[model samples]
Target: MKVFGFAGWSGSGKTTLIEQVIPEITRRGLKVSVIKHAHHGFDIDKPGKDSWRHREAGASEILLISDERWVLMHELRGEPEPDLDAQLARLSPCDLVLVEGFKAVQIPKLEVHRPAVGKPLQYQDNPAIVAIATDVPLDAPLPRLDINDPAAVAAFILQHQGLI
Candidate 1:
C-alpha cells in the first residue's frame, strides 16, 4: 500500500482536511484506509461491552463478528507501543493508506499548518513533508495548499501515489 501522513499542531485542521478528502478519494473507486494517531488514552470498547469484558477476562485477542462487520481487539498487556510501520502492517490491505501524525517518522506527508496559532512551520526543514496544507499564505519551498480545498489535496495524494 502507498502510505502518506497528515501532520500538524493542535487545531491546525489535519482531521478536518482528512475528513473532507476521504470520501472524495473513495468516490474515485480506490480502496483507502486511514490511521489516526492520538496522544492521549482512548477507548472504543465500553466497560460493559462483551468485547471489553472478554479483554478484562485476559483474552489476548478478541474477535467480534456480525453480518455487517467484524472487530478484532488485540490487548497490549505488557508490550511496548508499536511504531507506525508495525501498526500499518496489521491493517487490511488497501490501495492507499493515509496516516495522521507520527511526524518524526519518515514518509511522504502533508504538513497541515495554521499560522493564526503563531506556531512555527514544521516543514521548514522536514523533507518528509512533501506538501503543506494551510489556512495562511506561505512562501515555503514545498507545495502549499488551502486546507479547505479537499479535492486539491486528494489530487496531490493520488498523483504522488500514481493512483490517478
Candidate 2:
C-alpha cells in the first residue's frame, strides 16, 4: 500500500486535520488506513474489563472481538518497541496508509503547522516533509496547503501517492 505521513508538534492540529481528511479521501472510493504514534502511555481498555484483566495477568496478547469490530492488544513484556516497518506489516491490505507522527521515518509527509503554537517549522530539519498545511501564510520552499481545506489536502495526497 502507498504510505504518507503528517508530522507536527503537539497542538498543531495534526489529528484534527487527519480526522477531516479521512472522509474526504474515503468519499473518492479508495481504502485508507491510519497509524498514529502516541508519545505517552495510553489504555483503550477499562480497568475491570476482561481484556484489561488478561493483560494484567501477563497475557502476551489479547484479541477482543465482536460482531462490529475486533482489536488485538499485545503486551511488550519488556521487549523493545517495534519499529515502523514492523507495525506497518500488521495492517491488513489497503490502498493507502496515512501515518501520524514518526517524523523521523523516511516517507513523504505533510507538515501541519500553526503559527499560533509558537513552534518553529519542521520542514527545515525534516527532509521527509514534502508539503506544509497551515492556517496562516508563511514563506517556505515546499508546497503550501490550507489547513482548513481537507479536500485539497486529500487530493494532494492522492496525487502524490499516484492513487488518482
Candidate 3:
C-alpha cells in the first residue's frame, strides 16, 4: 500500500485531521487503512471479554473473528516494538495506509501543524514531508493548508503520491 505519515506534536490535530480525511478519501472509491502508533497503553478489549482473558492468560496474539470483521491483537509482551515497515507488512493490501505517528521513519509525510499548539515543526529534518496542513500561514517554501479543509489536504496527499 502507498504509505503516508501525519507528524506533529500532541494535540496538534494530527488525529483529528486524519479522522476527517479518511471518510472523504474512502468515498472516492479507494480503500484506506490506518496504522496508529499509540504513545501509551491502549486497550481495545473489554475487561471481561474472552479476548481480554486470553491476553491476561499470556496469549501473545488474540484474534477475534465474526461475519463482518476480524481483529488481530498482538501483545508486545516486553519484546522490542515493531518498526514501521514491520507493521506495514501486517496490513492487508489497500489503496493507502495513513500512519498517525512514527515521524522518525523515512516515509512520505504531511505535517499537521497548528500554531496555537506552540510546538516546533518536524519537517526540517524530515525530507519526506511533502506538505503541511496548518492553521497559520507558514513562512517556509513548502505548501501550507487550512486545517479545516480536509478535502484539500487529502487531495494534495493523493496527488503528491500520484494516486489521484
Candidate 4:
C-alpha cells in the first residue's frame, strides 16, 4: 500500500483534515486505511467489559468480533512499541494508508500547519514532508495547500502517490 502521513503539532488540525480527506478519497473508489499515533495513554475497550477483562486477565491479544466489524487488540506488555514498518504490516491490504503523527518516520507526508498554533514549521528539516496544508499562507519550498480544502488536499496526496 502507498503510505502517506500528516504531521503537525497539537491543535494544528491533523485529525480534522484526515477526517475530511478520507471520504474524498473513498469517493474516488480507492480503499484507504489510517493509523493515528497517540502520545498519551488511550483505550478503545472500557473497564469491566469482556474484552477489557480478558486483557486484564493476562491475554496477550484480544480479538473482538461483532456482526458489523472486528477489532484486534494486541498488548505490548513489556515489549517495546512497534515501529512504523511493523505497524503498517499489520494493516489489511489497501490502496493507501494515511498515517497521523510518526513525524520522525521516513515517509511521504504533508505537514498540516496552523499559524495560530504558534509552532514552527517542521518541513524545514524534515525532508519527508513533501507538501504542506495550512490555514494561512506561508512561503514554503514544498507545495502549499489550503488547510480547509480537503478535496485539494486529497488531490495533492493522489498526485504525490502517483495515483492520479
Candidate 5:
C-alpha cells in the first residue's frame, strides 16, 4: 500500500482534515487505512468490559469479535513501541495508508499548518513534507492548499502518492 502522512502541532486540525479527506478518497473507490500515533497512553476498552477484564487479568493481547466487526488490542506490557515499518506491516492491504503522526518518520507528508495555532511551520525542517495545507497562504516554496477544501487536499494526496 502507498503511504502518506499528515504532521503538525497539536490543535492544527490534522485530525479534522484527515477525517474529511477519508471520505473523499474512499468515494473514488480505493480502500484507505490510517495509522495514528498517540503520544500519551490511550485505552479503547472500558474498565468493566470483557476485553478490559481480560487485559487486566494479564492477557497480552485481546481479540474481540462480533458478527459485524472485530478489533485486536495488544498490550505493550512494557515492550518498546514498534516503529513505523513494524506498525505498517500489521495493516491489511489497501490503496493508501494515511498516517496522522510520526512526524519524524521518513515518509512523504503534508504539513497541516495554521498560523493561528501560534506554532511554527514544520516544512522548513521536515524534508518529507511535500506540501502544505493551511488556512492562509505561506511564503514557502512548496505547494499551498486551502485547509477548508477537503476535495483539493484529497486530490493533492492522491496525486502526490500517484494514486490517481
Candidate 6:
C-alpha cells in the first residue's frame, strides 16, 4: 500500500486536516488507514475495563471482541516502541496509509502549517515534506495549498501518491 504523511507542530491542524481529508479520499473508492504518533502516553482502554485489566495483569497483548467490533491491544512491557515500519506492518493492506506523525520518518508528506502557530516551516529542512498546506499566503519553493480546503489537499495527496 502507498503511504503519505501529515507533519506539523501541535495546534497546526494536522489532525483536523486528516479528519477532513479521509472522507474526501474514501469517497473516491480508496481504502485508507491511519497511523498516528503521540508524544505522551495514551490508552485506548479504560482503567477499570477488562482489556485494561488483562494488560495490567501481564498479558503481552489483549484481543477483545464483540458482535459490533474487535480490538487488539499490545503492551510494550519495557521493549522499545515499535518504529514506523513495524507499525505499518500491523495495519491491514489498503490503497493508502495516512500517517499523522512520525516527522522523522522518511516518507512523502505534506506539512500542515499555520503561521499563527508561531512555528517555523518544516519543509525547508525536511526533504520528505513535498508540499505544505497553510491558512495564509506563504512563499516557498514547494506547492502551497489552502489549509481549509480539504478537497484540494486530498487531491494533492492523491496525485502525490499517483492514485489520481
- Provide the TM-score for each candidate, comma-separated: 0.94, 0.99, 0.95, 0.98, 0.98, 0.97
- In candidate 2 the C-alpha lDDT for residue 87 amounts to 93
lDDT of 2 by residue, 15-131 (tens): 999999999999999899999999888889999899999999889999999999999999888898888899999999999999998878999999999989999999999999999
Per-residue C-alpha lDDT of model 3 across residues 109-140, encoded as one tens digit per residue? 99888878888887897898988899887798
User: In candidate 1, what residue range of length 10 has the lowest lDDT sum?
Assistant: 117-126
The TM-score obtained by model 2 is 0.99
Report the C-alpha lDDT of model 6 over 11-78, residue by residue, as the tens digit.
99999999999999999999999999999999889998878888888999999999998888888889
Q: Highest lDDT among the candidates is held by which one?
A: 5
Per-residue alpha-carbon lDDT of candidate 5 for residues 59-132, written as tens digits (9 for 90 to 100): 99999999999899999999999999999999999999999999899999999999999999999899999999
Better of 3 and 5 by lDDT: 5
Q: Model 1 over residues 1-164: C-alpha lDDT tens digits?
A: 99989988888888889999999899999899998888877778899988999899999999989999987877789887789989899999999999998888898999999988778888867789999898778898899988889999999999998999
TM-score of candidate 5 relative to the true fold: 0.98
- The whole-model C-alpha lDDT of candidate 6 against the native structure comes to 0.94
**Candidate 2 lDDT (Cα, whole model)?**
0.95
**Model 6 spans with C-alpha error above 4 angstroms:** none
Task: Show where candidate 3 strays beyond 4 Å.
Answer: none
lDDT of 2 at 64: 95
Residue 124's lDDT in candidate 6: 77
Candidate numbers sorted by TM-score from highest down: 2, 5, 4, 6, 3, 1
lDDT of each: 0.89, 0.95, 0.90, 0.94, 0.95, 0.94
